[model samples]
Target: MKQVRIHGPDDVRLDEIPEPEPGPDDAILAVAACGICGSDVGYAKLGGVQGPAPEPVPLGHELAGTVVAVGDRVRGIEIGSRVALNPGAAGFGLGSGGPEGGFTPRLLVRGAGLGKSLFPIPDDMPFEIAALAEPLGVGMNAVDQVDVQPGEKVAVLGAGPIGLSAIATLHDRGVEDIVAIDLSETRLEIARKLGAKDTINPKNDDLWNDLGRLHGTEQLYWMDLVDTDVFIEATGSGALLKKAIERGGNGSRISVVALHRQEVPVDFMTVLMKQMRLQGAIEYPERFENMLELLARRDLGPMITHRFRLDEFSTAFEVAKSPDAGAKIMIEIG
Candidate 1:
């Protein structure tokens, strides 16, 4: 079998390796499409804890595949069945938790653990769309944490794939007043198309002042600009998180869904004054089914912006890193 490995920084090589044999409780999936996640680019650029580059690391995670082989203990799922692979087998972090965990041509996923996190890709679900279920699930989980209520005001910081997913999920949940803030105009445009009621280019306008201008009289009563009820920080920057805390209204819930690089300073005074609730969210614990169900029903075909071949993995990573790339980028493995 041919596989791509990150031998070091800026170094990705295609190598031949023996196909994996499924354990008694595992099944083998022939990769159909794999989405290049932001985390994959992070790994390629910063490497892992082991060294400067995650040597011998496979570089994908958002994926969908067909079950080609099954183990003795595997059941329910059968050969030829198309499935979305939940890249985080154990979890997302160090060791075997990150994208390096799912970038292979064939994935050996534990059968019992599969549906608990994975979902059967509907026959009509295209491989490219199916590959997005994982990150969409992440966005779903973040929104689930906020428990967005209908007609409530919502603010999503960041316009990356997950951020945009949050907007779509919030819209689906009936949140009528949605404000999306990002540094990139292109991403904000994508957010608007995805259902964000308002888009803010934080670089050009004073986000807080604009909020006051938009909601004038309401700003006094709302105070923290969170009169909108919920605030979601998906930028993965601690500074933005601190700002979200400062800008959130009293009793407002702020869900921290992005992973930051280091310890970010926060104003305890601001957190105390507003009595804000800050919660951190990781990959979906059990939201993949609901995400798939939503995708299966909605007209979200435009969310996928680009596609590339497995051999073009390096270019795929570069595109993922590019600021102009929009929505999800999928790697056509097969």
Candidate 2:
């Protein structure tokens, strides 16, 4: 079996290892496709999220595969069944006290704990689309937290994969008056294609001024008269969070979906004064099934922008890290 391993920062190597055998209550999956997530870039460039690298770990989580073999006790999911592998490992990547987390040619997954998260990929769903269920699940989870309403004004900060996923999720939920704000024109264009009603290049225009110009009098009630009802900050930059807070209206919900690599200052006094709801969102806890269902139903396909082969994993990572790279970057495994 061959797997991409991150030995250290900027030190990824493809290594061959023993093929995994499923234990009791486990299933071995043949990797079909895996999406390179933003977190994988952080891990590959900055060791790990909060600490140093734990092991020379295989780093992909957004994946879809087929069941090649199953353990004696595994049920419901049988061999030869096509499935989308949920690398979130039933919420926290713990995998019911299994071995370390990874993305190898063969994945040994616990059948019982997998639950609805490990969905049966529809025959109509392509491998590349199936690979995106995980990140779409993340965006779904964030939108679920904010509870976006139809016709409500929304602003999505940062047009990265997650941010664009947020835009897609919001659009799917029927929010038509959605605005995507980002510094990169490429990402903004991608966001617009994914149903963002308006795209703002933050570098060129003052966000509040633009909002006021677009929304007229309604924008004045919010910061500098920007009438945004729900604001999602996905940049993971503390500066963006603070700016979103300052620009949001009273009682508006601002969801923080990005993982900040370092701590930065925020305006606690302004939050209290404005009575804003600042919420922190993590990975999908219960939205994976719904996201998978949406994918299976073909409601979300515009977000997948690029695909590569397993041997081209480094190029995939580079594309993911590149500013010009659009939505999800997927690697074909099988």
Candidate 3:
């Protein structure tokens, strides 16, 4: 078997390892596809987990696979079942530090509790797309934070994978007019394909003026632009956060879904004066099923713009870091 591990800053290795055997209460999966996350890039770039990268450490989480073997006590899932690994559950990838993750060709899940960390998917779904259940779950969790009413204006900052997913989720919720903001025109184009009503590139256009046009108002100031009922901050940019706060309507809800790389200062008065319902979203181990349902219907296949084999991880990582890269980058293992 081959597995990818991070040794130091900008260092990732694909090493040969022995196949894992399942315990009495465990199961083994033949990993099919694993999506590289932004967090994975951060961990790989810094060669650290908390502060800096440690010795050789496992580095993967978003994945889907087929159950190849199961222990005696693993009752719910059987051999040959297609499944998605929920890394948020214990004994999976999130907390376990061993040099094993979805990056490998196979995964040995510990405990009969394996059922708690896995979700079965339809046979028709592509493993590469199924791997998206994890990140899409993140978008679903973010959309779940706010009550986006039908016909109400909604805005999503950042046209990254998560942000685009949030826009699609909002569209599914019947919000027709969605504003997708980003600096990258390529990303904004993808957002438009995902059902975003308007795409704004602040680098070239005035965001406030654009919002005023979207709002159909002749004249508007920064504080006066308040038509958006739900604001989703997916960029983790303090400037976008301030813009979301400044442009949100009274009693609007804001969901901060991005993982901030640094501490961003916020104006308390802006939040206080408008009574904004601001909240943060974490991983969705329990909601993979919900995201799976959405994936079954939505044409989110365009989200994956790049695919690479296990041996091409170096090129894959480079593509993922590129400014012009599309929504999601996937690694397929067979």
Instruction: Highest lDDT: give the candidate number.
Output: 3
- The lDDT values for all models are 0.73, 0.74, 0.80
Off by over 4 Å in 1: 49-55, 89-100, 111-118, 215-226
**Residue pairs that clash (backbone atoms under 3 angstroms), model 3:** 47-53, 48-52, 48-53
**Candidate 3, 312: how far from true, in Å?**
0.3
lDDT tens readout by residue for model 2, 118-183: 568777788778877778878777787888899788888888878888888888778898888888
Q: Residue-wise lDDT of candidate 3 within 1-334, one digit each (tens)?
A: 8888887788888878899998888788899999988777777787756545446777778889999998887888888889987776755454235446778888877763556777898889999888888888888788887867788877888888888888888887788989999888889998998889998899999987787678543213246755677778888788778777777767778889998878777777878877778888877636568888888888888788899999998899898887477778899997
Clash pairs (backbone) in predicted model 2: 219-225, 219-226, 219-227, 220-225
**Location of the lowest summed lDDT over 10 successive residues in candidate 1:** 91-100
- Alpha-carbon RMSD, candidate 3: 2.3
Candidates sorted on TM-score, descending = 3, 2, 1
Model 3 has an lDDT value of 0.80
Cα lDDT over the full model 2: 0.74
Q: lDDT: which is higher, 1 or 3? A: 3
